[model samples]
Target: MTKQLLKPDYIFESSWEVCNKVGGIYTVLSTRAKTLQAAFPDRIFFIGPDVWRGKENPLFTEDESALRLWREHVKNEGLDVRVGRWNIPGHPISILVDFSPFYNQKNEIYTQAWLDYQVDSLHAYGDYDEASMFSYAAGKVVESFYRYYLSAQDKVIYQAHEWMTGLGALYVQKKVPEIATVFTTHATSIGRSIAGNNKPLYDYLFAYNGDQMAQELNMQSKHSIEKQTAHHVDCFTTVSEITNNECRELLDKSADVVLMNGFEDDFVPEKSDFASKRKHAREVMLRIANKLLGTQLDDDTLIIGTSGRYEFKNKGINVYLEALNRLTRDKNLKKNVLAFINVPGWVGEAREDLLERMNSDQNYTTPLKVPFITHWLHNMTHDQVLDMLKYLNMSNAADTKVKVIFVPCYLDGKDGILNESYYDLLIGMDLSVYPSYYEPWGYTPLESVAFHVPTITTDLAGFGLWVNSVTGHEGTLQDGVKVIHRTDYNYSEVADTIKDTVSDFSALSDQEITQIREHAASIAEKALWKHFIQYYYEAYDIALRNAEKRMKKQ
Candidate 1:
C-alpha cells in the first residue's frame, strides 16, 4: 500500500554560509531557497554559521524576552552560548549561533585555531583554522536550533551540507529521533583529502590521529558517512550520476535520486544575428590577445583557450599544456594557433610552488620541464593580469605574434578577464578544451557555447554526455559541441588531439564558424537553470515520502 506522504511543517538547511559568499554550494543553496520558500510559504528556514557582522547584513538579535529565555536555558544546562539571526532571501530567518565560549572551553586546538584564523585573514587566507571553526560553529548551531526551534507538534526535516555540518546532523538526529534527517555531500571530505594530501593515508586514516583529524575538521569517512546518512534518512540525493555510482560503490548505498548541477542561462544575452556576434567576438579576442602578448594578432588566426582552478593532474591543465606543446611543434599549425591558460591559484602557496618550478629555466624531468622549454610562462602578480602586452613578454613559445599566455591568478570581475579580456579570447578562439580527469561536472564548455564558440569536452563529463547524445547523429552538433573520448588522463592523447583540433580550427572558414554559432545557441537554450529546479523539487518529494513511510511503523 502507498503510505500517505509526510509533509514537513518546516525544512531547515545548514551550510557554512547561508547567503554571504563561498563556492558552488552557496550558489546552489541561495538559488534553491527562493523556489522552496515560494512552494512552502513560511515553512522554509536556513541555519548557518554567523561568520561576520555588519550593519547592512542581517544579524540575529533576539528580543529582550527571548534573550532572557535563551540565557536562562543555557545557564540551567550549565553551558554558555550566544545566538543571533540573519535574514537571507526566500527565508525570513537564518540562525547564527556563536559557541566560542563553549567550544573554547572544550577543545584547546579549536580555540587556538580560531584565534590564529582572525589574524591570518588580514594578510592571507587562513583556510585550515577557518574550516575547523566552521565545523565547530555548525555543531553549536544544531544544538541551539534543536533547543529553540524544535517542538512536539512540529514535523521538521533537517538537511546538512558537506562534512562541516555532518556533526550537526548527527547531533540533532541523536537528540530528536522523531525529526527526519538528511545529509547532502556537495563534495566528499575524504575525496578532497585524498586529492590534496600529498602523502599516503590508507591504513592510518581511521587510526586515532586520523580519526581526531576527521573529528576536528567535522568529516566522516566519505564512504561510511554517506552510507550512514543514507541508512538514517528515508532517501538520499547526490549531484551527479558519477557521484551516485561512487556513493553506491564506496558506501554500499544507492541514491534515491540524481540532482544535476545547473547554471543561470538567462544571464547570457541572446542575439538573433549570431554570425555578427561570432565575428565581433573573434575580432575583440584577437585584439585582447595581441595586447597581452605584446604582439599583433590577425582575426584569421585560430585561438584555443583553457581556464579553471590551477591544479595540474586533476583539472587537465597539464594535458592542455602538453597539447599546446605538440601543436606548436607542428610548424604548419604553430603560427596559426594560440592557447591561453587562465588558472587562478595562490601566488606563494604550496600549489603555486608547482607554477614557480615550471616557470624557472631549470627544467623538471619530462612534462613539467616542457612548459619552460616550449611554451611561455607569465608568473605575474594578480594585478598585472589586465596588462596584456607586459604579460606576454614572459612567454616561452616562439616569439611569434601568436603564442601561449599563462596567467596564474584569480579572476574576480569580467573587466579583469571575463568580459573585458577573457570573453574576447573566447570570442576570437575557434575551439576551447576541458579534458578533466576528475571534474565532478564541467561548466567551461557550456559557457564556451554561450559565447557562440565551439568546445571540446570529455565523455566522462555529465554535460558532455548530454551534449553528445543530442548532437552526435547530426552534423550540426559537431559544429558546436564535440565529445572527445578521454579513456584516461594520458598526456600523449591530449597532445595528439591538441595538434589535430588546432589544424581543424585553422582550416575553418567564416561560413563554418557561423553555422557552429547557430547550433550552439540552440543547445544553450534548453540547458538553462530554469529547467533544473524541477529536479530539486522531485528529490525533496522523495525524501518527504520516505520519511512518512518510516514514521508509520513507529
Candidate 2:
C-alpha cells in the first residue's frame, strides 16, 4: 500500500515583506496567513527584518510574554528581535529581527555562502548588502529556533520569498539540514530588469542568457543568489505559470510547484456596507476631480483610473496615456471621461490651490495653474507621465471631453488631496486599466475586479492570462475584464485597443454595466485564498518529501 505523505510539524516562512507592506508579496503572505494559521494553529511562524526598529509599526503588535524563553535565548546569541503577532486576520506569530549587527560580518557571511553554496556576491551593489544581511540573520533565527524547539523526528519546513530572502533560505539549508527549504521567486530579477530597460522581453525571451543579461543589467549578485537558491532548495516555486516560464528560462530552473498568489475575501465589505461605502467613494473621487480640473463632474461622469508602482513602461503608463490621448481626440465619445493616474511619484507636496478648493464649500470654475497633476513633483519637467502629457499637448482644456489627472502621492488614507486609501478610491472608479507590459502577477487589476470595478488588462499580465483561461474566451468589457493582446512591439496597437475599449464601454446601458460589475466580482471570488491555498499545500508536500529523501540519502 502507498503511504500517506507527511505534513510539516512546524513551518518557518521569511520574506522582506512580512509585516512590512512593500509590494504584492505582502498581499500574498498577509491574505494567506489566516488559512495556514487555521490549519497549523500556533505552529507557523514568520520572520521579517525589523526595518522599523524605533518607529511604531502599525502592522505588528509585539508581545513580550508569548515567547519569553525563546526570545531571551536568541538575545543571548546576539540576535536582536521582536517577538510579536502580525496585525492581520490570523495574527500569526512573527519574528522581526534587527539585522544591523550582521552588517559588520557581511563579508564573512558572503564568503561562507560562496564557499558552501557557490552563491556569487562579489559583484553586489545597491540594496544587495542590506537584503543579504537581513536574509542571513533570518536564516540564523530559524536555525536557532529549530535547534532549541524542534527535533530530528519533527517534520519542518523553511520557505523564503524572492531574491531578497534567497541568501537566508540557502543559509538555513546549509546549517539546519533537517529543515526543508522552499524558495519562491515572484518575478525573476533579470527578466524584470530586461523588460524595465526597454528590451524585447517576450520576443527575445529564448535567446537571452540569464548570466549574460544579469551582467549587462548589473543584476549579477541578485540573479546568482536567486538561481542558486532555486537549484539548491528542496522545493522551488513561483507565483504563476507565466513567471514559472521566466524561472525556467532566466533562472535556469523550473518551479517544483506553481504556488499562485491568492486573495482573502474577509476584507471585502458586506452587501449593504459595500453599497454605502461605494457611494461615498464615488462622491469623494468626483469631488476631488472636479476641484482639481475646475470642472463640475457629476455622477454620470465615467471615472477611470490606473495605479501601481510608477513603472512608466513596465506598468504600461505610457500606453495608458497614449490611449487617453486618442480617446480625447475621438469625436464619437458621448459622456464626460475623467481618467486618473493614481501611481505614486516623488512629489514635493499637495497643490495648495487644490487643497483650498477641497477644503472650501465654494465650487471653483477656473482651472488651477498647471492643473494636470494634483501634487507638485520634485522633477516636474522630467517625470514620465508629465513628459508624455506635454508631448501629446494634453492641456485638459475645458472643451475636451476626456481629462487626465495624476495623483503623485501615496494614497495611504492620509494624502491631503483625496484623503482616502487606494482601495477606497478604487471602488469609485467605473473602470480600472492596467495595460502592463511586464506584470508578473498583477494585484492591481485583481483588486480592481474584487472591488466590483470592471478593468482592462493585457494578456501579458498573469492575472489577465488567468482571466482568459477561466473565461475560455477573449476578455471584454461585457465579460467584466477586457484582456487586450499585448506584445513587445505592439505598443501602438495596445493603445488603440484601450481607446476603443473605453469608447465601447461608454455606450453600454446601466443594466449591462451592472452585469459587468457582477461578473468582475465573480472572477475575484475564484481567486480567494480558500480556493487557492491548495497550491501552497502542494509546495509544502513537495518540500517535505524531498527533504526526507535527501536525509535518508545522507
Candidate 3:
C-alpha cells in the first residue's frame, strides 16, 4: 500500500466567546467546532478569548509553566487582564480568550466621548463599544497569549475572525514569521457600516460627527488597525462576494477567497405532523384573543404572520403593516383574511398609544382583530397568552372561527412563548412575511422551509439571493415558496406585492399548497448545515497551505 499523504495541521480560531455568546461570531465558533475537530484531529485547533479557570472550563489545564509565562508577559507589558482556556475535543490544543479587561469594562464608559460615540455607533452602525473595544483588546490579549503560551517546537498557524480578532493573528505573525496568518471577515466594516447606515455616508460620517469618527478611524485606531490587520495576514476570506467587494473597495485589502457562513444541523427541529400542532395553535390563538381583545377568532379569517426585532424601516415592518391595511380593505378579503404581526418594539406605552387611537376610531368595534398589544409589553407568560386566547374563544364577542394573531415582541420561554407555538402558527399560516431592507443573511426563510412553511424574503437578504439563483428561471415559483424581487424598488410597489401575494395565496388550491411545502422542504434539506460544513474544511485547507508555503520559504 502507498503511504497516505499526511494532512496538514490546522487552527480555526477567533477572539470571542464560544459557549458564552455575545454575538454572531460565537455561533460561528461553536457550531463548526465538532466537525473541524473530527476531520483534522491531529492538526486542528480552535482558539478564542481565554477567559475561564477551574471548573468553569473543561480544559482546566494546570499547565503552570504556560500560565506563569503568560502572567509575566502580561504584567511586563501592562496588557489588559483576560485569562481562560478551554480545549476543543479531538484537537489536542484548542483555546478561547477571556480578556477581563474588555469583558469587565463592557458596560463602563471608558471615556465620556467614547460613550457618546457608542450611542452614535448604535444608531449609525448597529454596533456598540462591546464590539468596538473588543477588537483592540482582543488583539493585545492574543498577542500576549501567543508570546507566553505557544511552544517553539509546535508548528503553528493562525486564523482570526472578523475585525476584532484580525489584529491578533497579525501580532503573532510579526514574531513568528515562519507561521502563516489567515483572516476571515464574516462581514466587512464598510459592508455593515456604510451600506447598512440609515443616513447617507457623507452625512453620517463627514457631516455629523466627522471629526470624532475621523479620530476613531486613525492610523493607530481600531478601524485603521483592522485594515492593517488584513494587510498583514497571508490569506483573507470573506463571507460573500458582496462582502469581498466592500472589503477591497473600503478597507483596500486584497482577498484570497470567499467562505460563506453555515448553520448547525442539530438546532433545526424535526418535521412532525403539522396538522395536530396547527389545531392546538388555533386553540391557543383563540384563547389569546379572548384575553387580549375580549373576542374570539373565526374560521373565515386568514392568518398572515411576521416576526423579528423592532427595526421597522430596515426590517420592513412598515411595509408589512401597509400590506396588511391594504389587504384588510380589499372587498374580496374583508371577511376572509386577518394579519398576525409578531415584530418586537417599544410595546409598553407606544403599543397602548396605538391601540387607544385605534379603539377611539368611529369604525372600530369590540372583539378586535388582535389582542391587546399591552400583553406583550408586560412580558406575559406563554401559558398566560394561551389562557387569554382560551378566554377569548369562550367570549361571544369573538367569532371563535376568525384566524389572526399579532405578537409584538420576541418569543422567549421567559416571555411565556415557546418556539413550538410559533411553529404551529406558521404551519397554519396563510403566509409568512419578511421584507428586510438590509440583512447580512436571513435565517427565517431557511427555517420556514424546514418547518414546511412558505415564506417571503427580499432580494436584499443573502439567503434570498441564493434561493432565487437556485429556484427561479427553470422552475415555476409555486413549490411552497415565492421570492418577490424588491430590486431597489419603491415602498408602494412592495406593499402591492405583499397584498397581491396574499390574494394569490388565498386563491391557491390544496395541490399548490402541497407543492409549496414540498419545495420548501427540499430547499431546506440541501441548504441547511449539511452543505455549510464543507466551507469550514475548505477554509482550513487553504489556511494550512499558506502556512506550509511560509515554512518552506524560511
Candidate 4:
C-alpha cells in the first residue's frame, strides 16, 4: 500500500509567469491552475511581479474587494502589491508585487543572501538584478501575507518556479522557517547556456563540472542562486526524469520528486463546437497561404507548423527548416506542404502589400516580392530564419512543391495579419513539430496534441519521452505522435526523419488521418492535470513532512 500524504492547509506558489506569457512556463502554470484551485480552493495563492503597474494586463483581472485588508496591510508593510485573481482558468487568487521599490535595496539584499547562503551575485548582469529584486519582493510579500493572514499553527507550503524565483524561495526558507518550501527549476541556467553556445552537452555530460562550466560560460550568478535554492529548499523538484539527471549531475542535488507538467483541456473547443471552429480555421489558413504565395492550394494541402521561442539551435528551428528544405526535393511527396515558422521575432509590422492583397480578395498568380514571411522584421538581414532560408533557397515560389512562411509574431488574435488566437489556428494544422534539443517539458507539442493535431517531437523533449512511456514504445505519426531520436550530432539524421514523417503523414488516407487525430487527442487526455497533479501533491507531502521535522528540531 502507498504511504499517506501530508497536505498543506495553505499554499503560496510564486512564478515569474503567474500573469505573464513569456514561454512554456506560462502554459505550465496557467493550464494547471484549475486543478490546483479545485484541490486547495480559496487557500491557494499565487504571487508574481507587478511588471504592468501603470498599464493594464489583459491576463490579470484585479478585484479590490477580494483581499480588502491584506492589500492595505501589504502596502503599509512597505510593499506595493495588487491582490486579485488571475484571468486564466479558475481565476486563482493572485498577488502582483511591485518589485521596483526593492531595486534601491538590491545591494543590501545581495549582501544578506551572500551571508546566508553564499550566493554569488557579484558577477550579476542583464536580467539578474531585475529577477532577483522581483524574487526578493515576492519573498517579502509572502512574509507579510503569512504574518497577517496565516498563523504559525497553520500548515503552509510555498512553491517557487525557475531560477528567476530562486531568491524568493531561499528568502522564505530563511525568514519563514514555519512554512515548507518547494523549488522547481524548469531548466537550469548552465545547461541552457551550454546548449545555446553550441557545445556538445549530452556527448560530454559526465565530463563537465557544473561550477567550472558556470565560470567558463559567465553563468556564475544564475547557477549560484539555482544551486543554492535547490539545496536549501525543503523539497527540490524538477519537471522530468531527464531534468532530474541534469539536477543530479549539474547541481549535485537530486530532486526529491519529478513534477511532470500537465494541462487542463477546457480551452479546447467542445466536441459540438470543434468541427465548425476547425473548419473556419482551415478556411482562414488556406486563404492566407493562397494570398501570400499567390498559389491556389487545395484543402488537401498539408499545413504543418513549428512554434516556440526563436532559439534557432535549442528549439530546433534549424533542424525544422532543414527538414522542410529537404521535403521540397522529395520525389515521393504526395501533397503540397505549407510549413509555418510561427516563432515571434523583432517584428516591424504586418506586410502592408500582403494585407492589401488579402483585403482585395482578387486572384494573383504572381508572388509578393517577399513571399516567405507575413511580417516585416526590424533586422531582416540579421534574422536567422531569413538568413537560413536564403542559404537553403526555400523561397515560396509558385512552382515550388513545398512552400515556407514565417509568421514572426505572437498569434494572440490580433497580429494584423492572422487576426486569430494561436489555438484557433492550431486546430487547423494537419501536423505540428517541436524538435527541441534543450526542452525540459515541451508544452508547444503538448498543446498541439491537445488540440487534436498530431505532432512530431524528439525524445530529448519531456513530452516526447512521456508519450513513449505511455505508449510503451517510440510513438509513430499514425499513433498521433512521432518521437524522433535526437542527440548532440544527429542533426542531419533527425532532419531526414522529420522529412520522412511529414511525407508519410501527407499521404495518409482521410479515414486514417481522422483516426490519427483522434489518437492524438486521446494521448493528450492522458496528460491532463487530473492525472499528473498527483506528483505535485507528492512534492507538497515531502515538503510538509520535512518542514514538520525541522519545526520540531527548532
Candidate 5:
C-alpha cells in the first residue's frame, strides 16, 4: 500500500544565493519561489546571509515591522538579522542574517561538528570559514524561530542548498530532530575539482576515491562537510540525473529525489513586446559591431553568442573559440557571422572611443584600436580569450566574413557598454551556443532556448540530456537545440560539429528559422516550474517521512 504523504506546516529554505545572483542556484531558487509561495503563503520563509548590509540590495526590500517580536528576541539573543521580502515575482518573506559575529566562535562550532557529524574543517580555507559562519547563523535563526513559533505537532521541512549551507542543515538536524531536513547538492565538490583540474571525470569517476582526491586537491574540508551532510540529512537530493551519479561516486550516497531545475515564463516578454525588443536588440548589436569592426553588418547578418562563468576549460570557452576560428576559415559559410563572447572578465573600463562613436550620429566605417573587445580588461595579457585570439591570429579584420567580439563585462542593464541586461540582449540573438565541457545544469543554454533562440550545447550538459529525452532523438539546431556528443578526447570533433551546425543554420530560410524558434520555445514550455515542481513535493514528502521515522525511534 502507498503511504500517505506528510505535508509541511512550515517550510524554511536557506541558500547563499538567496537574493544573491552568483550562479545557476540563484536561477533555480528565484524562479521556483513563486510556486512555493503560492502553496504555503506566509508559512514559507527564506533565510539568506546579509551580505548587502548597509547597502542597497536590488533583489530585496527591507521591512522594519516584519516579525517584530521575533526580531527583538533574536537581537536580545545576540543574533543580527534583517527581515524583508525578496523582490521577485513571489515576493516571499526573506530573512537575511548577519553571520559575522559567529566568526569569533568558529573553533567551537567546528569542534562540535567534527565530534558529532565527522565533518572535517581542519583543512578549510578561503570562503569556507565565512560560508560556515553564515550557515551556523542560519541554523540559529531557524532554531530560534521554530522554538517561539512552531509546535511539536507541526510538520516542518528545512531545506539547505549546496555545501555552503551543509553545516547549517547539520545543525538543524542535531538541535531540532523533529524538523525534517533536505540537502540538495547541485554538483559534488570533488566532481567539479576533478573536471576543473583537467582530469577525465566521467571515464575515471568510478575508479577514483573522493576522499583521496579531496586530500590531493586540498579540498578535504568542503568534501567532508558535503559528504557527511548527504548521509545525515532526512532526504539528500540533487538537481539532475548527471549530478546524482556524481553524488553516488563521490559522496557514497544516492539522492532520494532528483529536483530538476525549472524556469518560469513570467520573465518572457509578450508577443508584441518580444518582437519590438528583438528588433531593438539586433539594432544595438549591429550598431556596436559595425563601429568596432569597421564593417556594415546588415540585417541579414547572423548574430550568435555564448555567455556564462569564465571557466576557460570547464565552460568550453576554448572549444567555442576554435569553432568560431574554423567557421571563419570555412569557405562554404553563406552569411556574415557576428559571434559574441558575452562572458564577463576583470574589465578595466568601457572603450571611450567606441562609446563616443555610439553616442554620436556619424557612422564611421573605421575600426577602433583594439577592435576585438568592447571594454579594456585589467590583465589583457593574462586573459584567456585574448591569448587564444592572438594565438589563432583572429584580428576581426575588415574583409573577414566572420568577426568575433568579446564583451568583457556584466550585462546588468547598467554596464557602460551594452546598457542592457543579459536577458534583454539575449532576445536579439539568431542562435546561441554553450558547448560546455563540465556543466552540471546549464542554465545558459536553457535560458537561450527559453528566449526562442536555437542553441548548441553538448550531451555532457544536464540540459542536453533532458532535451534528448524530450525529443526522443539526438537534439539538433533544426529542432531548436543541438546536443553535440562530447567526450574528453573529442575536442576537435566538437569544434568541427559546431562549425558545420553554424554553417547549416546560416543557410536556412527565414521561415525555417522561425519554425526552429517556435520549437525552442515549445521545449522551454515543457520545462516550466508547473511541470517540474512535483519533484520538489516528492522530496519534501520523503524528508517528512524520514524525519517522522527518526523521531519515532528517538
Candidate 6:
C-alpha cells in the first residue's frame, strides 16, 4: 500500500540571491530553477530584493506587462515591486521588491515580530536590518498575492532560504496560515560564527549552547530569528547532513528533510566541443600568467586552482597556500605546478602595467614588481593571500618550479585581466582543490567535476562526504574526487596530504588521466537535479500535510 503525495498548485521561493549574484546560493537557486519550472511551469514565483534600482541588472529582464492585474493589486498594497523574468535556463518569473520604505517602519515591524514570534532584534547589526526588511517585504508580497489571487482550496507553498529570509517565512506562517511554510537554513548562524571565529565546531557542537554562543559572538538577533523560524515553520529543512547536525545541536531542532544541492549539466559543453573549450580556456589562462610573471608556461604545465568566498581559514585558502608552499620542498614533485587563488577580495583595479605588457607583442625577461597578484588590491599589505605568500616566501623567481597567481577579482568576463567568466576559464585546470573547513555543500568542487576536471576536497564539505558515501570509501584521484579526512586540529596533516595527492596526480599516464576525467563526469551526472528533486518533493509533502493538520485544528 502507498500514499499519494500532496503537490502544490503554486510555489513561491524567496532568497537574497534571487537576482543578486553574491555566492553559492545564486548557483543553487539558478541551477535548480529549470528543474522546478519543468514540474510546474509558470506557477513558480521567485522573490528577490530590488538592490539594482535605477541600474541595469543583466541577470533580470523586466516586462511591465507581466502579471498586470496582480501588479496593480500589489502596488495598491504598498509594495514597490518589479515583475520580471530571471535570465536563466528556464527564465522563471521573478519579483524584485524595493524594501527601502520598510527601513522607516523597522521599529514597528520589529515589535510586531517580537510579539508574534520571539525574534530578538535588540542586538542586530550590520546587514541584519537590510536583510530583515527585504525578508518582511517579501512576506507581505506573498500574502498580498495569496489574498488577491489564491483560495483556501489552492495548494500553495512558501519557502525561504537562509536566515536573511527567515523572518519572511515566519511572517507568512502567521498571516497566511493556510499556505504551507518552509524554512531552509543552508548553514546556521551560530555554527558559521563559531567556525569563522576559529572555534572547533563539530567536536564541541553538542556541548555549546546556541544562546550563549550568540551572545559571545555578537549574533543574538540573527541566531534568535533562525532558531525561532526552524521551530515554527511548517517544515524545517537543510541542505546537508553536516548542517543538519548543526541545526540539532545549535538550534535545538532537526530538519524534517535534507535537500542536497544538485547540479544541472546544461551548462557544461557537449562532448563534441569539450576539448576545444578546454584548450581555449587553458591558452587564455596560461597567456595571462606568462605575461604577468615574465615566464612561459606551456600546455604541459599542471595548472591547479582553488576558489570560493575569501574566508581565509574557513575556505582553507590558508591551508591551500601552505600545501603549495610545502610542495616546493617535496622531492617527488616532478611537474611545474602553476596554482591560482581565484577568490575575489577588496580589489582596487586591474594592473595598468600588466595590461600594457599584455598588449605588447614583445617578450620581456623581467617579471613585474609584485608578480604574485593579478589585480591591484585596495589593501595590498593587509590582504590575507598576499600576506600568506610573503610569509611562505613564494615569490615568483626565475627558477621557482611552483608559481602561484592570486586573482583577487571576480572573473565575470569583465575583470580587465581574464576576460573569460569563472566557468569559462574553469575548464582549463588540470586539477582543482577546495579543501573547505566550513563549507556546507561545496559548489566549487562539484562544478570542477562537472567540467571533467578531477578535484580534491575534504570530508568537512557536504559534497565530499556525499562522494565518499556513494563510493563506500574515501576515494583517490582515480575515483574522480579525492576525499581527504579533515578535522579542526589536522591543518598540517591536510596540507601534507594535498601536496602528496597533487604530486601523485602529476605522474599518471595520459590514458589514466582520460579515465579519471570520464569518471569525474560520471560522478557529476549522478548528482543532477533529476535524482535530487525527490528530496524537495518530500519536503513539500511534509509541509502541506502539516499545514492541513493546523487548518483542521483551527
How do all models score by TM-score? Answer: 0.70, 0.98, 0.70, 0.98, 0.98, 0.98
lDDT of 3 by residue, 1-554 (tens): 95333234445365565434454555556656666666666355445544453345554343445446566667677563433333433323444444545646544523422332222222323343444454445455555555555554544556777766654565456556555577887665544444345544322322333224434443123454456666657777776654565566656765686665565556444556566766666655544544455543465445667776555555676677667656655554434555666655444433443345334423333544334353345544443333444543422234432334556655543344333445556656656788776665666666677767777777666667667667754223475556656644467888888787787777777788788878877877777545776655565556566766766777
CA lDDT of each prediction against the hidden true structure = 0.56, 0.91, 0.56, 0.92, 0.93, 0.93
The alpha-carbon lDDT assigned to residue 528 of candidate 4 equals: 93
Lowest-lDDT window of 10 residues in candidate 3? 116-125
lDDT string, candidate 4, 1-554, tens digits: 98999889999999989998788888889988899898889789999988988898998989889888888877788998888899988899999999998889989999999999999999999999999999999999999889988898899999999999999999998899999999999988999999999998887878888999999999999999999999999999999887887888899999999999998888899999998999899888888889998899988889999998989999999999999999999987999998989999999999999999999969888889878899999999999999999999877888888999899999999999989998999989999999989998898998899999999999988889989999999999988999999999999999999999999987889899999999999999999999999999999999999988888888
Give the Cα error of residue 275 in candidate 6, in Å.
1.2
RMSD of each: 9.4, 1.3, 8.7, 1.2, 1.1, 1.1
Q: Return whichever of 4 and 6 wins on lDDT.
A: 6
Report the lDDT tens digits of candidate 2 across residue range 218-241. 999999999999999999999878
lDDT digits (tens) for residues 1-554 of candidate 1 = 95554567778787776645656676667656656777777576676665564344443443344346765675565444343333444544555545344445435533343353211112212343344355445555556556675775776777877645554565555555556667776654444454444322322323324234444444433333334555566556677665555455444556776666665544354566555666776765555444433344576577777887665655666666666655555666534676777666434222243335433445233223223211233443332332333333334433543466554544433323334445444555567888765555667777788776777766656667667666654223345876666644345875587567666666666787688777776776566656676765565667666656666777
Q: Write the per-residue lDDT of candidate 5 for residues 312-416, one digit (tens) a residue.
A: 999999999999999988988999999999999999989998888888777677899878899999998899999999999998887888899999999988879
List candidate 1 stretches off by more than 4 Å.
1-9, 31-34, 41-43, 54-102, 105-155, 192-227, 270-288, 331-335, 348-402, 414-430, 469-479, 552-554
lDDT of 6 by residue, 18-53 (tens): 989988899989999999999999899999999999
What is residue 424's positional error in candidate 1, in angstroms?
8.1
- Please identify model 3 stretches exceeding 4 Å from their true place: 1-8, 15-17, 22-27, 41-96, 102-157, 199-222, 253-255, 271-275, 298-301, 331-338, 346-408, 417-430, 472-477, 548-554
Model 4 clashing residue pairs (backbone): none
TM-score, cand. 1: 0.70
| Better structure of 3 and 6 per TM-score | 6
Off by over 4 Å in 5: 1-3
- Which clashing pairs does model 2 show? none
Task: Estimate the overall C-alpha local distance difference test score of candidate 1.
Answer: 0.56
